[model samples]
Target chain A: MCGIVGLFLKKPELRPQLGAHLQTMLVGMTDRGPDSAGIAVYHRPVEANQCKLTTFHANPDYPWRKLGGQLAEALNAEVDVEIKANHAVITVGAAEGSARAWITRSHPEVRIMGYGQLMEVYKDMGLPADVARRYSLEGMEGSHAIGHTRMATESAVTTEHSHPFTAAPDMCLVHNGSLSNHNNLRKWLRRRGLEFETDNDSEVAARYFAYRLGEGATLAEALEAGLRDLDGFYTFTMGTRDGFAVLRDGIACKPAVLAETDDWVAMASEFRSLANLPGVEKANIWEPEPAVVYTWSLQEAA
Target chain B: MNTIDLSKTPVRELNQRLHDLTPDTNERLWRITNLKGEHALAVGLTVPIEVEIDGHVGYYCAGMNKEAKVVITGHCGVGVAENIMSGEVRVKGNASQAAAASGHGGLVVIEGDASARCGISMKGVDIVVGGSVGHMSAFMGQSGSLVVCGDAGQSLGDSIYEARLYVQGSVESLGSDCIEKEMTPHHLAKLERLLSRAGIEADPRRFRRYGSARRLYSFHVDQAEQY
Candidate 1:
């Protein structure tokens, strides 16, 4: 039994309260999932050429500044690394591919959590409250955020095995149910040049969406493809650079509730996570139908 | 009327207070405020009292209810009145999955839509939904009646037995061994009574009845290929 929560602010003026609202939403699901927690916040986008890479290392005292200096010299671009516990946001004045290739070639020990112009991913093995406090989630600001509390049904309870699994830049996926055909699907995706970071079933789904997006399918199209291709009882809430999307399997045994107000839209495994939101009493709430792909994008609003 | 604010008082204390009331107690009316989606609120009551919740609730709001009448003014989480024995459980808003699962005897009414498995494995309770219900509803139901004013999702009443299903709207697909039967006058009368009890206004003649075909009751050599 895992719990998934996502909040997308429809109004830009409410962006500063994104993490605070998300913290409450995540902590409310502690009883549903207490093993591990993770979050991906989309905020503070970089330039068209530059990118931001969120990296995680086991050791808290890892020399992030030294790597920043070395990367600056190696790539001939200004690199900035801001440390937060075992995670760091490394901003480089270069393209995402170059920065990613440089880190993979030179610093193989550092695990890149995610890379994009506007997204920062943070995950750890602890209670949702502790992880939120460790990352100072309430004080952070973002336009949208997605969080997951995992009970670890099909994978180990490690930082690497947590949800909000990232693949393409500014894209992450969180799952609430297990997949029966992930082992075979993982093999099928591996044959198509999609590299996996963990042996977790949810990571396979994340990379599957990435593979679809890489093939030029729109977000909703990719999820529609998942309805026919993927097999399991799953309720998935995915986040990308433009917005977020939610889908449930054909059987739809897993629970998911979506609520929307004039200012924001939120989804969780239950209504308890959304009960405390502002104007939630008047928000339009409904359960997403089975095999239906629901997408919300800020670009469309723009 | 007694008012208990859940924001200041814990759910445990509220339930304990309700449990302490005797059958002949004067406090027959309860008003619960500031629910904030709390779970296991006012469950396992055997007395004939009335409970009114003012907000949304989490899972198992009125499980194992006996003679109490629990009412929720807002949406509810999963298993709203699961395994209810006797009395009535009403939700003015929508309900999540497994709304009245395995209930024995009582009336469960949802004024709005109900999610997946609305009356799964129901024993003797009668459920009336004002709006639609999601997939796999009333799967393996036994010895009760289910009424849906709106549509029903896929696989309604899979492997059902003895339970009666009446729907006024479209049924996406019926499950194995469950088929629509001729709606007789007796069924229309029973459905009219059920709708009246739930305070819903729908024509009983427009409804359809479905139940078990009794083919899968026992193993037979003629159906060996299906096995």
Candidate 2:
């Protein structure tokens, strides 16, 4: 079981407090998932051409500056890196493909949490409050963010095993329930050359999206296909560069509530997590239908 | 009136104070403040006392209650008043999943909407929802009445036992062994009383009654694959 929360700000004025609001929502669902927590913040893009890669290291004092310098030298472009706790978000002036390949070959000890134009994900093995505090979540600013507090069911409780699994650029997925057929699905994807970091079923889901996106499917199309191909009781909250989406399995045994106002759209495991949101009492609150992919994008408002 | 500031005091102390009270206690009208969506507020009380929660509450806010009148001013998390034995539990705002689940006695009123599985596996209770309820509500309910003023989500009253379901609005779908039954005058009367008791304003004539068809009471060998 896990608790998932996603916030998409409709008003740009609320963007500065995105992390603060999301942190409160994440902490409210602490009872639902008590083991560890994860968050993916859609912060501003450092540069239009820059590829933002957030990486995690076992040691808190990992040589991020040295790694950043080497990466900059390798690409012959400037790299701006910021270290937060055990995670670092590096903005590089290089092609994402070559940079990812270089990191995979050279930095075997470090795990890339996510990579995108405007997204940075941070997750660790601890309580949601502690995790949020360790990252100084409230002070961060973004347009949208998604968080997850996990209660381990299948895999061991490790930092890599935590949620907000990133599979593609500007894409992250957090799951609330288990999949009965992840083993077979994992093998199916692995045969097709999808690399997996952990045995967790959620990783399979993340890779599924990455594989689909790699094959040139939009988020909506991939979600529709996922509804058909993926089997089990699951509620997924996915984050992209500009927006977020929520999906429930056919059975929809897992709990998911969505509340929206003119200023923001919020989704959480329960209403308590959303009750503190601005104008939530006046929001259009409802439960998401089964087998339906509900998406909201920044381009639509524009 | 006895006002307990939950913000200043812990849940254990507040509940301890309630547990120590008796029927003869003069301070029965207690007001709890700063709930901040906390859990298990005023649970397991035997005295017929009144509890007014000034704010939202968390999981199992009134679980396994007995002969207490608890009211929440804001929304509630999962399983509010779950397995209540008697008395009244009311939510001024919305309720999460499984509100009033497995209640044996008394009434539960939600002034706002309730999420999925409201009153699931209820042995006997009277649940009144002022607004809509989510999917799979009243699943496998044994006895009592579930009165929904608004629409019900998918698969309402699935595998229900003897409990009656009265939905004023749309039902997305019906569950196995649960079928829409005729709303008799007796049902209308009972529903009228339940609605009035819960302070819900709804016309009883517009409600649709649903109950068990007893088709799955004795499992059949042919339907084994279906199960």
Candidate 3:
């Protein structure tokens, strides 16, 4: 079982309060999942041609400035870095693939959490409140964000197992229920050469969506394929650069509630997480139907 | 009236306060405000008191209740009164999956539709859905009566045993081993009582009764395809 919360600000003015609102909502779900917490915020968008990567280092006091300078020297491009706790956001003025490959080949101790234009992820093994505090989530700003608080059923209670699994650029996913066929799916994905970071089921689901998306499938198409391929009781919340989506399994055993207002759109495993959002009373609150693809996006064109 | 605001109060504290209440407590009415869909709220309440929740609630809002009456003025998430032993839990709005799953005794009423498996694995409880119900409701119901004032989704009362099902509207399809039985006078009388108790005013004659065919009770080689 886990707690998942997401918010997409319909109004640009709410960007400043995005983290504050998300912090309260995530903290409200402390009891539902007490072990670990994770959050992915799509903050200030870099230029369309540039990308940013959020990385995690095992050593908390690792010299990030030196790494930033080394990355700049190797890539021959200016890099901007911001260190938060054991994680750091390195914004480079280049394509995502080359920098990703450079980091993977160079820094063996550093693991990439996410890579995208605006997404920055922070997750760790601790209480939601504590993790949020460590990330200074209240001060962060974004147009949208997705958060998760995990209660491990099969995987180990480690930071790596914490959710908001991001296997694609500007894409993150969170899940509430365990997958029934993850072990087999893991082997299949591995055979297809999709690398996995942990023995977590939600990661596979995210990677599956990422793979489908990478193959040029739209978010809706990829999610529909997930429904056809994946076998489990899952209530998934996914975030992309310009899109947000929610889906449930055929049986829809796991709980998910959605509320949309003029100002923002929110989703949670329960209502408690959404209650604290502004203008909630007037929001059109309802439960997402089973086996339906509910998606919202800023890219209204096409 | 004892009011606990969930905005400032943790769910554990609220449940602990409800758990500490005795039948003879001085306070008779407890108002829980700003629930904001918190899970396990008022869970395991044994007192014979009444709790009125102002807003929405999360999973298992009144789960495993006993004697206490918990009313939700807003919609509820999954398993509103799951594993309910005894008590009256009322939802003013729709309920999510398995609204009264595995309830043993007492009555659970949902003013709005409930999702799939509303009474899955139920045991001796009365569930009244003011609106429609989703697919596979009462999947493994052992005993009790499920009254749906509106239409029922697919596989109503699948693999049911002994429990009686009453649907005022159309049933999408019957489950395996479950058949629409003739609404005898005795069953109609029971349906009337249930409808009246649930504050539903539909005519009892419009309703149909469904129950087990008793064929699946004992395994037979000829009925192997049914499994």
The candidate that wins on TM-score is 1
Winner of 1 and 3 under DockQ: 1
Per-residue lDDT tens digits for candidate 2, residues B118-206, read: 99998898999999998899999999999999999888999898999999999999998899999999999999999999998999999
Across B80-137, the per-residue lDDT of candidate 1 in tens digits comes to 9999999999999999999999999999999999999999999999999999999889
Fold similarity of candidate 2's chain A to the true chain A, as a TM-score: 0.97
RMSD of each: 2.4, 3.6, 3.9
Per-residue lDDT over A1-302 for candidate 1, one digit per residue giving the tens place of the 0 to 100 score:
99999999999889899999999999989988899999999999998889999999999999999999999998899898999999999999999999999889999999999999999999998899999999999988888999999887665788898879999999999999988899999999989878877888888899999999999999999999998888887999999998999999987889899998889999999889998999998887888888999999998655
Number of the top-ranking candidate, with lDDT as the measure: 1
Model 1 Cα shift for residue A250 (angstroms): 1.7
State residue A302's C-alpha deviation in candidate 1, in Å: 3.9
Task: Give one digit per residue, the lDDT tens place, for model 3 in A1-302.
Answer: 89899998888888899999999989977887899999999988899878999998868998888988998999898899999999999999889998899999988788898998989999888899999999899998888899999887787888888889999999999899989999999898899999988888899999999999999999999999999899999999999999789999988878788988888999988787888888886677778878899998876522
lDDT of 3 by residue, B1-227 (tens): 99999879988988888888788998879999877666788889898999998887778889998999989988888888998888899998888888889999888999888888889999988999998898899988999999998999889999898788999999989999999899999998988887777776788898888999888845467877877
Q: What is the lDDT of residue B80 in candidate 2?
A: 90
Docking level of model 1: medium
Clashes of each: 0, 0, 2
Candidate 2 global lDDT? 0.89
Positional deviation of B104 in candidate 3, in angstroms?
4.5
- DockQ of predicted model 3: 0.55
Model 3 ranges off by over 4 Å: A299-302, B1-30, B36-50, B62-69, B82-87, B168-173, B183-193, B201-208, B218-227
Q: Which regions in candidate 1 have their CA more than 4 angstroms from the true location?
A: B219-227
